[model samples]
Target: MKITTLIENLKNDSQDLINESGLSLYIELDNKRILFDTGKTGSFITNAQKLGIHLEHVDAVVLSHGHHDHGGGLLPFFKVNSKAKVYMKRKAAGDYYFHILGFNKNIGIDKKVFEEYSNRIAYIDRFTEIMNEIYIITDIEEQDLTPRGNKYLFAKEGNKRVQDKFEHELMMVIKQQDGICVFTGCSHKGTPNMIRAARTIFPSLDIKAVIGGFHLMTIPMLKSFSASQEEIQAIAQMIVDENIQKVYTGHCTGVKAYKNLKHILGSKIEYIRTGSQIYV
Candidate 1:
């Protein structure tokens, strides 16, 4: 199995949005081409073209969330690969809100944009095995994980917490001779919850490595967005608990937070910033 980042703040030899939140990753598995979330703008397309990716050949597409940064490129994608199958969580169609420091934002998307190919659309409310061993972990139950509603979280109708369910996120397990590799867009549903869910899905499978965005950009979420070094150290310990093999994170994961996580995860943390690639 091989995964190529088509869109990210990090570009290839081409010049594009270098600090953008949008990320498009091309994942190859089981002889099928799977397209992860389309980056915010058409940077995904430009990057792919510059890097020689044929968008028309993508077999399937997955959404990691309704955020503009993740969904903005889908419409344009349809204009090209109109026959590709699309998959995402059922709650993805629900109305979402985002309360910013100065304003309230409505970030909900229309179902038709993704559901037009009804015969090819598969909505997973919980979990679904897309192929023989590939699975899509839909929005996790908000029952136990931390509350998504926070000072930075936005909502609609008074801007309540939008339960993304990691709605657009999927946990891909690529079976290797000795272990499996798990890839995700962002663990908004919580990394611990994602790990546990993966364990339950394949009780005997061992996760070899982790790659993609981590969304550790906020202080409230990072434990040291703007605090002293002492607080950052505590945050590092929190990340070490996951025991994940290699952490190749980027996008919302800030430079400071990445450094802190690197200190804790040690050599296990394989950092991937803008324009970097991790081969597995």
Candidate 2:
């Protein structure tokens, strides 16, 4: 499989790419082109063009969650790629908010995109094999070590907003001959939990690599870390314990947290940026 970072929070060294507080990956696997996420805006489209990625020919699009930074490019994507079906968790259209400093800010995807492109969107509520060897896992029950940064996130239940359980988040697993590659958007549920869930589902397959954000940033505005050094070290230790071959993370995984992880994982971990590419 070949994966290219279409959009991310950082930029590749000396590369002409648009950087945003979002994540998007272009994947070529099993003769199919898959778009993992759309990033926060249509800016990723420009980055795709620069990288010589033809979005029009993309075969499938998988949204990692309901967050705007993950699925905000749906409108522009539908405008270009009319044939690809965009997949997301069933409740991904529900209202989501970020609560901080006594303020509630809407941070969910645009509901109109779901309404207008209803025919082109697929709502997934269970373990589904979207294509040969490509699977989407939505039932992540292992909640060990979920991100502390998620404390500020909430979702509407009725008239009241409650803490988000992150049921709207999903993980993508691509099963290859050697092992499986996991793709996550922000890992709001927790990276360790997601990995455990993936292992539970595919206990026979070795996890070759895990990719995407780990959501370790407490406050982006203040640039503070949510996970303590010990917590970050534990996560890094978990990765090492699991024997995960490689980890490509960025976006919500703060620089300090990444450094903390790097201190332990060393060459096993890498920080991905806009225009970054990986082959597995």
Candidate 3:
């Protein structure tokens, strides 16, 4: 499998690529070209062009959640890719918001995009194999060590707003002959829980690598970490316990948190940027 970082919060040493506080990965596996996320805008499309990635030929699109940073490029993508079906959690269209400092900001995907590409969007509510060896796992029940940064995120339920349970979050698992590679958008459901969920579903397959943001930033306004050093250590220890071969994370994972994790995980963890390319 080959994966390219289409857009991310950071960039490589090259000045040719653009970076944003979002996540998107172009994945090629089993003769399939899959777009993991759309970043926060059409900038990912621009980067793709620079990287010589043909978005028009993409086979599928997977929105990690309802967050705009993940699905905001749906409109631009639909304009170019006419055949790929976009897959997302069934409840991903819910009214999500980021409430901080007594203010509420709408952070969900654009409703107009949903109405425009209703037919091409696939709303998944359960475990589904979208294609051969490619599966989407939605039922993440083990919630230990969920991101403390998620405290500010909420979803509208009827007339009242409640903390987001993140049922709308999903993980993509690509089962290869040796093991399985996991793709997460922001890991709002918690990285450890997502890994456990994948392991539970595919008990026989080894977890080769986990890619995407861990949502470790607690205060976005000040760019502060929500997870304490001990918490980060625990999360890293969990990864060690699971015996994951590698972890590629960035975006909302926060620099401080990444460094803390790096101090523990060492070479087992690596940061991915806008122009990063990985083969597994």
Candidate 4:
């Protein structure tokens, strides 16, 4: 299996988006093309075209959650591949804040986006295998022991305060010989918590790599907003313990936070920017 980021805000190359967040990718099982989330703009399509990647070749598309930064590109994707299976939580069709460093990005997928392709869509709220060696983590809860990372994420249904509990998100783990390469789209499920779930749900598999957004970077005003350094350290330690050899994270990872993460992970962490491609 080979995982790459076809579209993103930042990139290793000079052409990468500086601060803007964009497209993400998740290819699994050697041939299965699983696109996790679309970037915040139509550039995802443009980037795909630039890379000579055909949207029609994707086997499935999954919206990690309902943020425009992650789900917005679906509009262009829909226009190209109108018949692929799109897996997402049913509740993602509501307005939510893709909160970030001192800004609120509104993201919500309109029902019309999938109205024509409803027959090929699957809304998952539990653990399910979409294909051989690919599993989706759904409605994950916070860890009972550890207490770091973002604890404020929540969901609202109509007028009620919904416990985000990371329920609207989904994660894909691709089994590999050395271990597994995990793909997440803006891990609202808490980075550490997602890793733990990956271990529990797929105890037989080892996580070799992780590639996606870990919305750890919080509001710009650091005076009381943002995940603590202790939490970051703990998460970093967990990754090392799990033996994950490589990491490609960006988008919601906040430039500052990820910089710290890179230092901690050392040679094990590799940030994937826009137009970045890696053979895992």
Tens-digit lDDT string for candidate 3 (1-280): 9999999988988658989889999999878999999988999999999989999999999989999999999999999999999999988888999998899999999998888889999999899999898999989986578888899999999999999998889999999999999999988888888888998999988889999998889865468876876668767977899899999999989788899899889999999999899988
- Which scores better on TM-score, 1 or 2? 2
* Model 1 Cα lDDT, one tens digit per residue, 209-258: 76666555553233335423443454344346545566677665556667
Q: How accurate locally, in lDDT, is each candidate? A: 0.62, 0.90, 0.90, 0.70
Worst 10 residues of 1 by lDDT: 142-151
Q: What TM-score would every model get versus the actual structure?
A: 0.80, 0.97, 0.97, 0.86
- Indicate the worst ten consecutive residues by lDDT in candidate 3: 219-228
Q: What is the lDDT of residue 63 in candidate 2?
A: 96
Give the per-residue Cα lDDT of candidate 4 at 175.
73
Error of 1 at 94 (Å): 2.3
Comparing 1 and 3 on TM-score, the stronger one: 3
Give the least accurate 10-residue stretch of model 2, judged by summed lDDT.
Answer: 219-228
Q: Which stretches in model 2 have alpha-carbon errors above 4 Å?
A: none
Q: Candidate 3: TM-score? A: 0.97
TM-score of 4: 0.86
* Per-prediction tally of clashes: 11, 0, 0, 4
